[model samples]
Target: MGSIDSYIFRTTLTSFAVVMASLTGVIWITQALRGIDLMTSQGQTILTFLGLTGLAVPVLILVIAPIALMIAVAHTLNRLATDSEIIVMNAAGLSPLRLFRPFVYATLVVSAIVILIGAYIAPDGLRRIARWDSEITADVLANVLQPGRFAQLEQNLTIRVRERQPGGLLVGVFIDDRRDPNDRVSIIADHGTVLKNSEGSFLVLEDGHLERFQAGQQEPALVAFSRYAFDMSKFSRARDVAYGIREHYLWELMWPDPNDPLLKQLPTQFRSEMHDRLLAPIYPFFFAAVTFAFLGLARTTRQSRNFSMIGAVLCAFVVRLAGFALSVIANQTPYVAGLQYLLLVIAIAVSVWLIRRNVVIEPPARLVDALNALTASLSRLVRRPMPA
Candidate 1:
């Protein structure tokens, strides 16, 4: 590569990295906030909370890479134009296609990243998260029982612990069971530990007393025992991990097992996900073409570049939104999936044709005039004096 090509490639990739990290961090923080219950309610440590939340980063990158590439391309092109470098290159007989070569290289790199994450890493992260969530649900004693908080294990059943010590020791354990209408039972234990075996989960209480208040009788029965087992198997959730279509690997989606239950139930969803993953890498190329078509030309300072930038961004937005809408519609109408590919093809083809022919894209004159008039009216309203 030549010096100019190297410079453009490096600048665009650097910009892409910065934009990608910034956007991912902001979005990931919002997503992580939703899972704060893992720490606050479940009594998990901060490290565990972050580890579970960080698993979502690969998925976020899959969505953000194409947009970042477009932004980086636009920034590099605008910078070159602002410095009159594009004009100088054009004067030196550099064609639009030659100038776009560096952007294509950068886009390819971003596309590879998207492909890698979408195919394997993102799906694996989702699967791991699902498995971890299932484990947490099945281990009800550790997750649901919080120190000093009365945890409602089920309707009409409550349990509380005064304190939870290290190595899963519970102090001052109390349980109230009103599940049976005929007899209300309450048990107070000095201390207990959760025991899970092949049979089921049991709370082995030591030095506890059980009181049974019969509904028909006036006197209640009290019994004290040195050791008692409270069956807690019902509180544990199902351990079977049911992964969704988005959690499956790319190859699994491409050729799904005919006997798979999820596939048998939602065939269209499998098809939609397969197409979405297949098309993930191509978006960066389409975005780069669209951005270059609008802002790649060498324009003088007298001409407004802001409109071109806006047009490029709007076009990218429309294309991505259309693709997403098509993918969703494909879940119901299988035939709609093909439109995603067609949209990308048409958009990229048109963009490349414009670039080759040096056709500068601009908003319609009427729209620009209307916006200017609206701005003037708003300015006048703001500047008008208040009536006393």
Candidate 2:
């Protein structure tokens, strides 16, 4: 009995590891490709990119782990049946219930992990990613102007023909400042540099022209300049936090500040979001049960045994789509109608039924007899001589 238990555990764990690693690799590669544009725009370093990717792994694992486990278990059981190991176990008085112990243990371990990630780790990682993005955006905006391009710095200022010298000094600067709602000012220079002057940072233009347009004047007044300075520090400190649902944790979602502009008008959306995040962890357990149960519809060794695997995948898609649709509907409605709770209850009931049905039942004898007869007919047909 000890040997059998050990063998089952080892085989199942091996399968689990293979499936997890492969799925994680595939998901990571896809995410990395999708994020390339954002990464480049942020001027992210290789180390930063790698760190973000690493942090994403835990979230992916939490989401995909159950599906991986289901696939691994189904594949392993199929192999066992094909090799006649299950038949041998049956002959040795190993009941189906006894054989399911390892899987149950595995499911418990996976469920705990899923709970941890969904509740804590994922939220923390999300916060960090948001902060990193804010920082990168600040950096990009600070140095947005470039050479041979008319860079529009906000709505009021336009810079044309900007260049930087070897000493890190910028030259050939042109600035059009229309920032004043009542008056418009435009400055151009043959040679100028951006400097951190006493009054914040300033662009000191040399040998330039200044044009001021008064509100009532049809013609703009033009003035020549020897040296003119404009403040260069247009980019302000980053106000990183947003009042969006994605930025908050579970508790924050439930008890969001009424003072927050985002939550000031609509509280129902926040409540629905909280429910959705809280319920995400339950999906893995549901998937595990569904996969195990559906796999038992046919003998594990049946060549058409992939039906359950396909069903499991479909189940995942349907659940995701349903959740999305529910969230949208919840946002539109004014009250919390217990729809999420109802789904949870239905999922639990279905999962329980699947597990119980799969664990205790055996494939029908009539089906087996039919399969045997079909196999015999196919065998003779293959061996028969071809018609000349």
- Best-matching candidate per lDDT: 1
Which portions of model 2 show Cα errors greater than 4 Å?
1-14, 38-42, 51-59, 140-143, 154-156, 160-231, 254-264, 296-303, 315-324, 333-388
Q: Report the C-alpha lDDT of model 1 over 1-388, residue by residue, as the tens digit.
A: 9999999999999999999999999999999999998876676678878988999999999899998998999999989998999999999999998999999999999999998899999999999999988877777777888889899988989999998776668889999999999989999999999898998889999998999999999988999989999999887756888889989999999989999899999999899999999999999999999999999987788778888888888899999999999988999999999999999999999999999998877778898899999999999999999999
Q: What total of clashing residue pairs does each candidate reach?
A: 0, 1
Top candidate on TM-score is 1
Model 2 steric clash pairs: 201-232
Q: Rate the local accuracy (lDDT) of all candidates.
A: 0.91, 0.69
Displacement of residue 364 (Cα, Å) in model 2 is 12
- Identify the runs in model 1 with alpha carbons over 4 angstroms from their true place: 146-158, 162-169, 176-186, 191-238, 364-388
Query: Which residue pairs clash within candidate 1?
Result: none
